[model samples]
Target: MIIFGTALLAVCHLLGIFLGDLLGQALGVKTNVGGVGIAMLLLIFARIYMQRRNMLPKLTELGVEYWGALYIPVVVAMAAQQDMVSALRGGPVALLSAIAAVAVCACVIAVINRTERPQAQTDGAPILHDNPLLTEAE
Candidate 1:
C-alpha cells in the first residue's frame, strides 16, 4: 500500500542519517554532513531499482512521488533557517566561495549546453529547452 512507500522512505532516511554521521566522524566533523541529500539519493535509486524490477506498485509509487515532491520544499525550508547572516559576517571567504560556486555552475551549464545534442521525438514536436531564453521566438 501507500504506507509501504513511506516505510521505504523512512528506512532510506534512517540509513542516510547513520551513514552521514559516520562520514562526519571520519572527516573530523561534529555535524551530520549531507544526511538529507543522501536520503534523497537513496530514495531516487531505490525508486529506480524497484521500477526496473517491476517491484513497485502504482499506488505505492504515487505515495513515494507525493512524499518526494513534498521533500524538496521541506529541505528548502530547513536550509532557509541556516545562519547565513553569521556566515557572511564571519568572513569574506563565504561570499567569495558563493561567487566561485555560482561561476563554476554557470560554466558547467554552458559547456553542457554547447556539447549536448537535441534528440528528435517520434511525434515531431519541438523539444523544449529548460531555459525559456534558449527557446525560439514563436
Candidate 2:
C-alpha cells in the first residue's frame, strides 16, 4: 500500500535527522545539517534495496515515485529559506567551498562519462511515415 512507502520515508527521515543531529553536535553546530539530503539518500538506497529483493509493491513504488517527483521543488523551497546574505557575510569559506564542490562534481561527471561504454551509433536516415500529415509536403 501507499502508506507503506510513506512509512518507509518517515523511518528514513527520522534516522537521517538523528544522524544529522549527531553530526552537527560533533561539528559543534546547533542545527541539524544535511538532514534532508541524508533522508533522500536513505530513501534512494531503500528503494534500490527493495527492488533488488523484489519487495517493492506497485502501489508503494508509485507513492515513492510521487514523493521523488516533489523532491527537487521541496529542496528548492528549503534552500530558498537559507540566509544567503548571512552566509556570504560569514566569509569566503562558503564561496570557496561551493566552488570546490562544483569543481569536484564536474570532474567526477567527466570521469564517469569517460569510463561509461559508448552507445551504438544510429543510422542517419529519417524515418519514413505512412501518414501524409507527418511527411514533408512534396
**Tens-digit lDDT track of model 2 for 14-97:** 998899998899999999988878988999999999999999999999888878667758876768568576667869988888
Cα error, candidate 1, residue 73 (Å): 3.3
Q: Could you tell me the lDDT of residue 17 within candidate 1?
A: 94
**lDDT per residue (tens digit) for residues 1-138 in model 1:** 889889988998999999999989999999998888999999999999999999999999998998888887998677756847766786988778878988999999999999999987686667765767666555
Models, CA RMSD each: 8.0, 4.1
Task: List candidate 1 segments past 4 Å from native.
Answer: 122-138
* True-structure lDDT of candidate 2: 0.85
Worst 10 residues of 1 by lDDT: 129-138
